[model samples]
Structures are given as C-alpha cells and as structure tokens.
Target: MTRIVFLDRDTLPTRPFCFDFPHDYAEYGLTAPDELAARIAGADIVICNKVVFDRAAFAAAPRLKLIALTATGYDNIDLPAAREAGVTVCNVRAYGNESVAEHALMMMLALMRNLPAYMRDVAAGVWQNAPFFCHFGAPVRELHGKTLTLFGRGNIGQTLAGYARAFGMTVLWGERKGAASVREGYTPFGQALAQADVVSLHCPLNAQTRHMIGEAELQMMKAGAVLINVGRGGLADEQAVLAALKYGQLGGAGFDVLGQEPPRNGNPLLARLPNLIVTPHNAWASAEALSRMTDMVEANVRAFVAGTPQNTV
Candidate 1:
C-alpha cells in the first residue's frame, strides 16, 4: 500500500480526503520545521501547503515519490531539489479565480466609496448627531467612467475585468515592466500607471516582478488613484506604500497579502490609516474555492498513483 502524509492539514480547513486506492494515510494539523523530516519519513506521497521542503528534507525522504500541493503556488517547495530526488510535484490551479477576483472587487468598491471611514463614523454615533440629515466626511468616488488597469491577464484578472466593465469602467491590460515592445492587447507599463484611476496586481512574484511597485512606480500613478493587490505581498514595497498613503500620493490602497505572512515581527503597512485596508491573506479562502482546491489535490494524488500524473508543476 502507498503511504500518504499531509504535513499541514489545518491550512485547508476543508473536508477529509477520500482516496480510491489502498493507502496508509496520516495527517498533522500543523507541522513545525523540526518535525517535518520525521513526519514525512517512509511516506510515498507528501501533501502540504506553505510548508518549506529543502534539499535536506528531500534527501531524508527516500521513499517519497510525489509532493502534492494544496495551493496553486509551489514556491515554498524547492523544485530543483524535488527534481533531483525524483519526486513528482503537482499543484492546483485556477481554483481560486472567482474567489480572489471577487475579493479584489470588494476592496476596490469599499475603498472608492470610503466605506470603512463611514462605518467607523456610524459606530462612533457621529451619524446620529449629524449637522444635516446625512454625514459626508470622506470623498466618495464611483467606479463608472474610471480606468481600471490590470498587471496580469490571467483567469482572475479577466474575471475582474468583466466585473469592472459591468460597472461602466474601462479596463486596460498592462504589459510587463521594462519590456522592449508592448504586446498587442497590453498598454505600456508606465503609461498604464499614469492613466489608471485604479490599478490591480495579479501577476506572480518572481525575479523581475518582486518589488515591482516602488517609489518610482507610485510617483508615476495618477494622483489619488487606488491600488489593489491580491497577489503576493513581495510585489510591492511596504514602506513606499505607507509613505504614499501618508502623503496623500494615493487615494487608497488595499492588500490581501504582506511580504511576510503572520507578520510576527512588524510591517510598515500595518499602520492605522483611514485610506488603507489590509486583509489577513484570506482572499483565496472562500468556501467554494477551498472545496475546489481540496478536490483538485485529491485528483492529482489519485492520478499520480495510477501512473498518469496530472497538474504537474
């Protein structure tokens, strides 16, 4: 029988797996760095999300044949080490498209309408003692007649474009930064920033994309334009964003991720600002998305065992 071990099962917060093949399955709610090697020892398949597996771990797991990922990103795993160890790696994809797109849209609408500021005022009884029938403190902007520029043209970005179009907003796909020539359907990077009333980032973080948005990019944006990031946190410089928000260089900013998750140390973007909104990286954790991700993970594992690996990364 094949031995399967899930290192960080609590990350999914979903239903238990139902494998079709005969297997010895084991799971841990959360696995620490020191506990990983022993937990995965002698296992034919290892499933994980956000667990870092280095060359040492791969070397220790002599029986490991497959590394099934619950999330779309496999950055946490060392792909080179896995390849050398003869381990087949697979990751779920497009499962969180709708969930993440909706989250980004929600943040855009809330920031543009100054929803958070008004809710705070209402909670403080400011609305009850209003000078007039209504209280209008912060500037409220509409999505209609505005330009929405997207950095990535993936499934999530396309879905967001459709939603923006429904609200009468013009959508533009931005070409990669520092490219020699612009793509057919994409606007140049700097030009897109200057013309955008709102900019959303959906591109993956890599060598050329990490810290892609810094002081220079912020200065290029239209004054009082909103910035939305549901992608990786390392895509933007947190200090630069904080300064932009403080100096009124940006109308507002929304982020679902930070450079370092759990942010146990500290982050400049964590400052209390009326124009800033930060979510705890739950943009891809909607019930529907989680269900799809778990199902895909199961399918990947089953297919690998049947000698036809699917969703290989």
Candidate 2:
C-alpha cells in the first residue's frame, strides 16, 4: 500500500485528484515549512506545487520514493537533495503550451493597441460627451510588419512564434545571452533586442537570467517598443520598467508574473500605469491546460509505481 500526501492542495483551484491504482492518500490545503516533516513522516510519495521540500524534509521521510510536481517549474524543490535521498522527481511538460501562448498574445495585443488606457477612458465616461465618432487617448499600433523577438525556444515560445507569423509579424528567436556563437536559426540576443518592435520572454529564471533585462537592456530597446513577459517575474527589473514607463522610454509593458507573487509588501510595477498590464500569474491555468496537467500527473505516478518512470526532471 502506498501512502501519498499532498502538501499544498490549494495551489490548484479545481480538483478532486484521482488515482487509478489503489493507494492511501491525504491532502492539506496549505503546509508551511515547519509542518513538512510531520505531515510527510509516513508517506511513501509526496505531491506538491509551489511547496518547498528541503534536504531536511527528505532526510526525515525515509520511506519517500517520489516527489510529483503538478506544475512544470521545479525551482521550488531542491533537486540535489532529492537525488541524494534517492527520491525520483517527475514534472508535467508541454501541457500549458497553448494556454500560455494565447495569454502572451493577449497581453501583447492589449499593450500594443493601448487597450488599457482606452478602456479606462471609456469607464470614466470620457466617451459619453462624444466630441466625434470616436475618442483616442494614446497611440495604437498594429501587429503586422513588426519584428517580434522571442527569448525562449521551448514549446510555448515556438507556439507564440507561429501565432505571430500568422498575424503577418516577423519573428526572431533570440540566442542565449553572451553565447560564444549564434545558432543557425537564432539572432544574436542583443541585436534582436535592438531590432524588436515587440519583445516577449518565455525563458526560465536561473543564475545567468535573473534580472537579464535591467536598465541597460531597456535602454537598448527602441523608444516606443513594447515588452511582454509571460515567464518568470525575476527576468526583468521591475523598478527599471516602472521608471521607463514614467519617462516614456518604453511604450508599454505587460506581465503575467511579478518578482514576488501576491506582492503584499509592495512593488513599483504594481502602480496604475496606463501603459502597463499585469495578470495574477494565471496564464497557464486555462481549463484545457489544467485538465491535461491533471491527466499527466496521474500517468506519471502510475508509471513510477509500475517499475517505469516518465517525464523525469
């Protein structure tokens, strides 16, 4: 009999997580760092999303065989620690490609057309007194004929490139920063940044990529170009973006994630900038994506239990 424990069940909004095989399972709405050991003491498997499992937690759970992630990103878990403890880790991939690509497009379209400011004007009754057929408060740009630079070449980024191409926009895949040589299909990273009318990021955050787009990078962008980040929040310098928005250096910006989620402490980008749009990191939470994620999770667990494992990360 396998004992599986889900440390943070509230991470996913919709659930009744099912397993095809017979096993004993338990779930906790939320679990803090201090509660990890006690909650997983007797468990043979742990399932989590956005929950941190350190070396100590792994050492405490001698019977733990697997750590199943409900999301793609595994930055929250300690990989080396899991490996040292002989715990197999698995994550679902490509499940949210369509959902995330669509979200990046929505953000780009909204910012490019100045939809936020226009909507605000309409909501404030600025259009009620009708001076003419229509009213415009800011410059509206079209997607056609603009150069779009994508920072990641993964599934989500490739999907967005297809979408951009279908809209008559030219797309450039950017090579890694400071790479010794450029790849066949990728543009030199900095050169692509300079040529882009719209820049979208889908890269993972790590040592080399944290704050990859700071003040200097912002200065390199075209004066009126827009930036869209549907990836990690730490990829850009939030304060620099705010300053750019204030001084008109950046035409507009859209972000689906922040440097810190729930940003309760406060963030400069959280201000009501008409040219900026921020979503609560739900770009990958579409109904279809969630269903696929759930199905993959079940499959991964079943395969691991049957002497084979898939999607190891």
- Measured over all alpha carbons after superposition, the RMSD of each candidate to the real structure, in angstroms, is 1.0, 1.1
TM-score for candidate 2: 0.97
Runs of candidate 2 with Cα error greater than 4 angstroms are none
Best by lDDT: 1
Against the true structure, what is each candidate's TM-score?
0.98, 0.97
lDDT for position 285 in model 1? 97
Per-residue accuracy of model 2 over 46-147 as CA lDDT, tens digit each = 999988888888888999999999999898889999999999999999999999999999988988899999999999999887799898689999999999
For all candidates, the clash counts are 0, 0
The lDDT for every candidate, in the order shown, is 0.94, 0.92
Query: Model 2, residue 246: what's the lDDT?
Result: 93
Q: What's the CA error at residue 148 for candidate 2, in Å?
A: 0.5
Query: In candidate 1, how many clashes are counted?
Result: 0
Cα deviation in Å at residue 134, candidate 1?
0.5
